[model samples]
Target: MDAQAWDERYAASELVWSREPNRLVAAELADLPPGTAVDLGAGEGRNAIWLASHGWSATAVDFSQVALDKGARLAEGLDVTWVCADATTWQPPAPVDLVVVAYLQLPAADRRRAVRNAVTMLRPGGTFLLVAHDSTNLTEGTGGPQDPAVLMTAADVVDDLSGLDVEVVRAERVDRAVTTAEAHRGEDRRTARDCLVRVVRR
Candidate 1:
């Protein structure tokens, strides 16, 4: 979807996504010491807000102003900067300790650009974490975007960040418990198969 379409979606609902951070983000980064971080394509700024509360200075960037506005309201006192800008084009003022791009679905080419953009803003020894609906999710999993071009895989992530000076911590597909809200859409739904990738800059 384009910027206008995303904005419309955000405006359609009081809140599109949950307020909590992604399960993968919390599970993987909870042990690491907090630092400067960016939540690229932060839909409603949930992850960014969560990071700020967890002692990280976070920035939430998205192309939808409606989402950013809701995020600002939800993050009254936290140390978070909300930026209504395209994730593939925007860059932080300086390199940060962590860069998180979660569930930002786009075409393969556009997704690679966004992932590379996030990776390029990471400082040496910093972390770049990403999670998305895996391509197989369309066929095997319960919920996610249906478009194959927008979905991702572990290998796709590895390829997207190629040539970057980074160590691949973990890159694979994993099952995530589908929320009750999501499961209501259909039957035989319990988990969402997603691509999880974590890397540390060298």
Candidate 2:
């Protein structure tokens, strides 16, 4: 979706995504030591806020100004830097210890470019975590983007980061509980979410 569309979506509701960090992200980085982190396409800054609260100096980047504004408001006193830029093209000011790429759906080519760019931002031995809706979510799972072009699998993500020394810390079709009102109105939806993939820059 374009920035305006996302802005409208965010404007229509108090929050598009939940206020909490993504379950996968929390599970993966829970034990890691705090450091400099960059959240790419960080909508509403849920993950960024959580990272900041946990002692990580986080920079949340999003294309939509409204989303950044909302994130900033939600982040009140948290140590988070909100930057408005397209993830597919934005480059961080410097390398970071950790880089996060959450559910930033886009066409295959764009997604690949974005992931590549994010990986490049990681410092040597830095960690890169990616959490995205698996492609099967539309067909076999409950709720997610209907466009197949934007959906991807863990293998697809690994392929996008092929050159990096990535370890499949957790890669499988895991079930995600959807509690959003729109999602819950129907049968309990169990969409597939990509698990953890820990990568170190070579």
Model 1, total clashes: 0
Where is model 1 poorest over a 10-residue stretch in terms of lDDT?
Answer: 180-189
Error of 2 at 53 (Å): 0.4
**Clash numbers, per candidate:** 0, 0
Clashing pairs in 2: none
Per-residue lDDT of candidate 2, residues 1-202 (tens digit): 7899989988998899889999888988999899999999998999999999999999999988898999999999899999999898888788899989888888889989998898889888788888887888877776678998998887787788877665545555667776545554765445455434567776
lDDT of 1 by residue, 36-139 (tens): 99999998999999999999999999999999999999999999999989999899999999999999999988888998899899999999999999999998
lDDT of 2 at 125: 77
RMSD of each: 2.1, 2.4
Candidate models: Cα lDDT each: 0.92, 0.85
